[model samples]
Target: MSAVTVGQELASVPYDELIKNILLAMVAAQNEANASFIEGINDLVGTEVKIKYKEDSTEKEISGNALAFGILPTLLQIQSGIIEIKMAITLQQTREFQVGVKARMGFRVFSASVDAKYQNTYSYKVEGSSLVRIQVAPAPPPQPLMRAIEYIASKTAPTIP
Candidate 1:
Protein backbone atom coordinates (compact mmCIF):
# COMPACT_ATOMS: atom_id res chain seq x y z
CA MET A 1 0.00 0.00 0.00
CA SER A 2 1.01 3.62 -0.64
CA ALA A 3 -0.19 7.06 0.60
CA VAL A 4 0.63 10.69 -0.30
CA THR A 5 -0.16 13.96 1.44
CA VAL A 6 0.37 17.74 0.92
CA GLY A 7 0.50 20.55 3.49
CA GLN A 8 0.85 24.38 3.69
CA GLU A 9 1.34 27.13 6.25
CA LEU A 10 -0.91 27.03 9.27
CA ALA A 11 -0.84 30.76 10.10
CA SER A 12 -1.71 33.58 7.72
CA VAL A 13 -0.27 37.08 7.56
CA PRO A 14 -2.58 40.05 7.98
CA TYR A 15 -1.59 41.95 4.85
CA ASP A 16 -4.09 44.76 5.25
CA GLU A 17 -2.81 45.69 8.71
CA LEU A 18 0.78 45.43 7.57
CA ILE A 19 0.25 47.80 4.65
CA LYS A 20 -1.68 50.24 6.83
CA ASN A 21 1.06 50.27 9.46
CA ILE A 22 3.74 50.87 6.87
CA LEU A 23 1.89 53.83 5.39
CA LEU A 24 1.22 55.24 8.82
CA ALA A 25 4.89 54.99 9.75
CA MET A 26 5.82 56.84 6.57
CA VAL A 27 3.42 59.65 7.41
CA ALA A 28 4.72 59.86 10.96
CA ALA A 29 8.30 60.18 9.77
CA GLN A 30 7.31 62.92 7.35
CA ASN A 31 5.55 64.81 10.11
CA GLU A 32 8.62 64.60 12.33
CA ALA A 33 10.85 65.91 9.51
CA ASN A 34 8.49 68.79 8.78
CA ALA A 35 8.41 69.81 12.42
CA SER A 36 12.20 69.82 12.69
CA PHE A 37 12.56 71.82 9.44
CA ILE A 38 10.04 74.45 10.50
CA GLU A 39 11.75 74.87 13.85
CA GLY A 40 15.17 75.37 12.19
CA ILE A 41 13.75 77.69 9.52
CA ASN A 42 12.39 80.07 12.16
CA ASP A 43 15.89 81.52 12.72
CA LEU A 44 16.56 82.08 8.99
CA VAL A 45 13.08 83.28 8.06
CA GLY A 46 13.64 86.89 9.11
CA THR A 47 17.33 87.04 8.11
CA GLU A 48 18.42 88.13 4.62
CA VAL A 49 21.39 86.68 2.74
CA LYS A 50 23.04 88.60 -0.10
CA ILE A 51 24.33 86.93 -3.29
CA LYS A 52 26.55 88.77 -5.78
CA TYR A 53 27.11 87.35 -9.26
CA LYS A 54 28.63 89.39 -12.08
CA GLU A 55 26.15 88.26 -14.73
CA ASP A 56 26.75 91.28 -16.96
CA SER A 57 27.67 94.07 -14.52
CA THR A 58 25.00 94.08 -11.76
CA GLU A 59 24.71 91.95 -8.63
CA LYS A 60 21.51 90.02 -7.82
CA GLU A 61 20.24 89.14 -4.37
CA ILE A 62 17.55 86.62 -3.44
CA SER A 63 16.11 86.96 0.06
CA GLY A 64 14.60 83.70 1.14
CA ASN A 65 15.54 80.43 2.79
CA ALA A 66 14.40 77.76 0.39
CA LEU A 67 13.78 75.43 3.30
CA ALA A 68 11.22 77.90 4.65
CA PHE A 69 9.46 78.14 1.31
CA GLY A 70 7.87 74.74 1.34
CA ILE A 71 7.51 71.56 3.27
CA LEU A 72 9.63 68.56 2.31
CA PRO A 73 8.34 66.49 -0.59
CA THR A 74 7.36 62.90 0.04
CA LEU A 75 10.26 60.68 -0.92
CA LEU A 76 8.58 57.29 -0.78
CA GLN A 77 5.78 56.01 -2.95
CA ILE A 78 3.92 52.69 -2.75
CA GLN A 79 3.96 51.41 -6.31
CA SER A 80 3.64 47.91 -7.61
CA GLY A 81 3.76 45.00 -5.15
CA ILE A 82 3.87 41.24 -5.30
CA ILE A 83 3.52 38.20 -3.06
CA GLU A 84 4.45 34.59 -3.82
CA ILE A 85 4.35 31.25 -2.07
CA LYS A 86 5.39 27.66 -2.81
CA MET A 87 4.70 24.37 -1.01
CA ALA A 88 5.70 20.73 -1.46
CA ILE A 89 5.06 17.59 0.56
CA THR A 90 5.30 13.83 0.28
CA LEU A 91 4.24 10.75 2.32
CA GLN A 92 4.66 7.07 1.57
CA GLN A 93 3.97 3.68 3.16
CA THR A 94 4.85 0.20 1.97
CA ARG A 95 4.22 -3.39 3.19
CA GLU A 96 5.47 -6.69 1.88
CA PHE A 97 5.04 -10.40 2.78
CA GLN A 98 6.43 -13.68 1.47
CA VAL A 99 5.78 -17.37 2.19
CA GLY A 100 7.46 -20.55 0.92
CA VAL A 101 7.14 -24.29 1.52
CA LYS A 102 9.35 -27.20 0.47
CA ALA A 103 9.01 -30.96 0.93
CA ARG A 104 11.17 -33.96 0.13
CA MET A 105 10.25 -37.58 0.44
CA GLY A 106 12.57 -40.58 0.16
CA PHE A 107 11.73 -44.21 0.72
CA ARG A 108 10.27 -44.22 4.28
CA VAL A 109 9.87 -40.73 5.79
CA PHE A 110 8.83 -37.29 4.56
CA SER A 111 10.08 -33.87 5.71
CA ALA A 112 8.62 -30.38 5.13
CA SER A 113 10.01 -26.82 5.64
CA VAL A 114 8.20 -23.52 5.72
CA ASP A 115 9.50 -19.91 5.62
CA ALA A 116 7.78 -16.51 5.90
CA LYS A 117 8.89 -12.85 5.75
CA TYR A 118 7.22 -9.48 6.31
CA GLN A 119 8.36 -5.85 5.94
CA ASN A 120 6.84 -2.37 6.41
CA THR A 121 8.15 1.15 5.68
CA TYR A 122 6.86 4.69 6.02
CA SER A 123 8.23 8.16 5.04
CA TYR A 124 7.06 11.77 5.14
CA LYS A 125 8.40 15.19 4.05
CA VAL A 126 7.21 18.80 3.85
CA GLU A 127 8.58 22.12 2.51
CA GLY A 128 7.13 25.58 1.95
CA SER A 129 7.92 29.31 1.96
CA SER A 130 6.48 32.77 1.21
CA LEU A 131 7.78 36.07 -0.14
CA VAL A 132 6.57 39.66 -0.01
CA ARG A 133 7.87 42.52 -2.11
CA ILE A 134 7.09 46.17 -2.78
CA GLN A 135 8.35 48.74 -5.28
CA VAL A 136 8.58 52.46 -4.45
CA ALA A 137 9.75 55.80 -5.88
CA PRO A 138 10.06 59.42 -4.84
CA ALA A 139 6.83 61.42 -4.91
CA PRO A 140 5.74 65.06 -4.50
CA PRO A 141 3.45 66.19 -1.76
CA PRO A 142 -0.31 66.16 -2.35
CA GLN A 143 -1.79 69.21 -4.07
CA PRO A 144 -3.86 70.43 -1.14
CA LEU A 145 -0.93 70.21 1.25
CA MET A 146 1.29 72.00 -1.23
CA ARG A 147 -1.20 74.84 -1.53
CA ALA A 148 -1.41 75.22 2.24
CA ILE A 149 2.34 75.27 2.58
CA GLU A 150 2.62 77.93 -0.12
CA TYR A 151 0.06 80.12 1.61
CA ILE A 152 1.85 79.76 4.94
CA ALA A 153 5.23 80.55 3.40
CA SER A 154 3.85 83.65 1.66
CA LYS A 155 2.33 84.94 4.87
CA THR A 156 5.55 84.35 6.82
CA ALA A 157 7.83 86.13 4.35
CA PRO A 158 9.79 89.07 5.83
CA THR A 159 8.95 92.48 4.41
CA ILE A 160 11.96 94.37 3.02
CA PRO A 161 12.19 98.10 3.85
Candidate 2:
Protein backbone atom coordinates (compact mmCIF):
# COMPACT_ATOMS: atom_id res chain seq x y z
CA MET A 1 0.00 0.00 0.00
CA SER A 2 1.27 3.50 -0.96
CA ALA A 3 0.11 6.77 0.61
CA VAL A 4 0.30 10.23 -1.00
CA THR A 5 -0.62 13.58 0.57
CA VAL A 6 -1.45 16.79 -1.28
CA GLY A 7 -1.87 20.36 0.07
CA GLN A 8 -5.02 22.25 -0.90
CA GLU A 9 -6.85 25.42 0.03
CA LEU A 10 -9.37 25.21 2.84
CA ALA A 11 -12.83 25.00 1.37
CA SER A 12 -15.00 25.58 4.42
CA VAL A 13 -13.78 29.04 5.47
CA PRO A 14 -13.19 31.99 3.14
CA TYR A 15 -10.96 34.99 3.80
CA ASP A 16 -13.65 37.53 2.95
CA GLU A 17 -16.06 36.00 5.46
CA LEU A 18 -13.41 35.99 8.14
CA ILE A 19 -12.55 39.64 7.48
CA LYS A 20 -16.23 40.61 7.52
CA ASN A 21 -16.71 38.99 10.91
CA ILE A 22 -13.64 40.76 12.25
CA LEU A 23 -14.98 44.10 11.03
CA LEU A 24 -18.31 43.49 12.75
CA ALA A 25 -16.57 42.70 16.02
CA MET A 26 -14.45 45.82 15.70
CA VAL A 27 -17.59 47.92 15.31
CA ALA A 28 -19.06 46.48 18.49
CA ALA A 29 -15.82 47.16 20.35
CA GLN A 30 -15.77 50.74 19.09
CA ASN A 31 -19.31 51.26 20.33
CA GLU A 32 -18.37 50.00 23.77
CA ALA A 33 -15.33 52.26 23.83
CA ASN A 34 -17.48 55.27 22.93
CA ALA A 35 -19.83 54.55 25.81
CA SER A 36 -16.95 54.16 28.25
CA PHE A 37 -15.32 57.39 27.09
CA ILE A 38 -18.60 59.29 27.54
CA GLU A 39 -18.94 57.94 31.05
CA GLY A 40 -15.38 59.01 31.84
CA ILE A 41 -16.02 62.56 30.59
CA ASN A 42 -19.18 62.81 32.64
CA ASP A 43 -17.31 61.71 35.74
CA LEU A 44 -14.51 64.16 35.10
CA VAL A 45 -16.95 67.01 34.64
CA GLY A 46 -18.68 66.16 37.90
CA THR A 47 -15.42 66.04 39.87
CA GLU A 48 -14.72 69.03 42.12
CA VAL A 49 -11.57 70.59 43.60
CA LYS A 50 -11.01 73.41 46.08
CA ILE A 51 -8.21 75.66 47.27
CA LYS A 52 -7.81 77.93 50.32
CA TYR A 53 -5.67 81.00 51.00
CA LYS A 54 -5.02 83.47 53.78
CA GLU A 55 -4.79 87.23 53.32
CA ASP A 56 -3.40 89.73 55.85
CA SER A 57 -5.82 89.43 58.77
CA THR A 58 -8.34 87.62 56.49
CA GLU A 59 -9.01 84.15 55.12
CA LYS A 60 -10.41 83.31 51.69
CA GLU A 61 -11.48 80.11 49.96
CA ILE A 62 -12.01 79.14 46.30
CA SER A 63 -13.80 76.24 44.54
CA GLY A 64 -13.59 74.90 41.02
CA ASN A 65 -13.86 71.82 38.76
CA ALA A 66 -11.02 69.35 39.07
CA LEU A 67 -10.15 69.93 35.42
CA ALA A 68 -9.59 73.61 36.24
CA PHE A 69 -5.93 72.76 36.91
CA GLY A 70 -5.36 72.00 33.20
CA ILE A 71 -8.30 71.57 30.90
CA LEU A 72 -6.07 71.26 27.86
CA PRO A 73 -4.03 68.35 29.20
CA THR A 74 -7.01 66.67 30.88
CA LEU A 75 -9.43 66.90 27.98
CA LEU A 76 -6.68 66.18 25.50
CA GLN A 77 -6.19 62.78 27.03
CA ILE A 78 -9.88 61.95 27.15
CA GLN A 79 -10.66 63.12 23.63
CA SER A 80 -7.55 61.57 22.18
CA GLY A 81 -8.23 58.06 23.44
CA ILE A 82 -8.39 55.80 20.39
CA ILE A 83 -7.77 52.12 19.64
CA GLU A 84 -6.83 49.87 16.70
CA ILE A 85 -7.07 46.13 16.21
CA LYS A 86 -5.30 43.84 13.76
CA MET A 87 -5.78 40.19 13.01
CA ALA A 88 -4.04 37.39 11.09
CA ILE A 89 -5.57 34.12 10.05
CA THR A 90 -4.18 31.06 8.35
CA LEU A 91 -6.20 28.14 6.97
CA GLN A 92 -4.82 24.84 5.72
CA GLN A 93 -6.28 21.72 4.20
CA THR A 94 -4.64 18.46 3.17
CA ARG A 95 -5.77 15.47 1.17
CA GLU A 96 -4.20 12.03 1.54
CA PHE A 97 -4.65 9.08 -0.79
CA GLN A 98 -3.87 5.52 0.12
CA VAL A 99 -3.50 3.01 -2.71
CA GLY A 100 -3.59 -0.74 -2.32
CA VAL A 101 -2.92 -3.48 -4.80
CA LYS A 102 -3.36 -7.27 -4.76
CA ALA A 103 -2.02 -9.66 -7.35
CA ARG A 104 -2.52 -13.31 -8.05
CA MET A 105 -0.40 -15.49 -10.26
CA GLY A 106 -1.42 -18.83 -11.66
CA PHE A 107 0.40 -21.28 -13.93
CA ARG A 108 -2.76 -22.72 -15.40
CA VAL A 109 -3.26 -21.64 -19.04
CA PHE A 110 -0.82 -18.79 -18.44
CA SER A 111 -3.56 -16.51 -17.17
CA ALA A 112 -2.98 -13.56 -14.85
CA SER A 113 -5.24 -11.02 -13.12
CA VAL A 114 -4.71 -8.01 -10.83
CA ASP A 115 -6.92 -5.86 -8.52
CA ALA A 116 -6.20 -2.29 -7.27
CA LYS A 117 -7.96 0.00 -4.75
CA TYR A 118 -7.48 3.58 -3.59
CA GLN A 119 -8.84 5.55 -0.61
CA ASN A 120 -8.81 9.34 -0.13
CA THR A 121 -8.98 11.20 3.17
CA TYR A 122 -9.01 14.86 4.04
CA SER A 123 -7.82 16.90 7.09
CA TYR A 124 -8.15 20.60 7.98
CA LYS A 125 -6.32 22.95 10.34
CA VAL A 126 -6.87 26.58 11.22
CA GLU A 127 -4.61 29.05 13.00
CA GLY A 128 -5.35 32.60 13.96
CA SER A 129 -3.85 35.45 16.02
CA SER A 130 -4.75 39.05 16.85
CA LEU A 131 -2.96 42.22 17.93
CA VAL A 132 -4.40 45.26 19.66
CA ARG A 133 -2.84 48.72 19.75
CA ILE A 134 -4.03 51.94 21.32
CA GLN A 135 -3.34 55.35 19.78
CA VAL A 136 -3.71 58.52 21.89
CA ALA A 137 -2.40 60.97 19.33
CA PRO A 138 -5.77 62.19 18.10
CA ALA A 139 -6.05 65.70 16.76
CA PRO A 140 -6.43 68.57 19.21
CA PRO A 141 -9.90 69.48 20.44
CA PRO A 142 -11.90 72.12 18.56
CA GLN A 143 -11.28 75.71 19.62
CA PRO A 144 -14.90 76.33 20.63
CA LEU A 145 -15.04 73.27 22.88
CA MET A 146 -11.68 74.10 24.43
CA ARG A 147 -12.80 77.66 25.07
CA ALA A 148 -15.99 76.49 26.74
CA ILE A 149 -14.17 74.10 29.08
CA GLU A 150 -11.58 76.74 29.86
CA TYR A 151 -14.37 79.17 30.66
CA ILE A 152 -16.00 76.69 33.02
CA ALA A 153 -12.66 76.04 34.68
CA SER A 154 -11.98 79.72 35.17
CA LYS A 155 -15.46 80.36 36.58
CA THR A 156 -15.23 77.52 39.10
CA ALA A 157 -11.58 78.05 40.06
CA PRO A 158 -10.99 79.21 43.63
CA THR A 159 -9.83 82.76 44.25
CA ILE A 160 -6.94 83.79 46.54
CA PRO A 161 -7.07 86.95 48.57
Q: After superposition, how far is residue 47 of candidate 1 from its true place, in Å?
A: 3.2
lDDT of 2 by residue, 2-45 (tens): 22224222222334454455466655666576566556655666
Q: What digit string (tens of lDDT, one per residue) describes model 1 on residues 36-100?
A: 65565555545445444565676655555543444344434444334222321212222323123
lDDT (C-alpha, whole model) for all candidates: 0.40, 0.44
Q: Candidate 1 — worst ten consecutive residues by lDDT sum?
A: 111-120
- Flag clash pairs in model 1: none
Model 1 misplacement above 4 A: 1-13, 48-127, 142-161
Worst 10 residues of 2 by lDDT: 106-115
lDDT of 2 at 64: 59
TM-score between model 1 and native:
0.35
Point out where model 2 deviates above 4 Å: 1-15, 71-122, 125-161
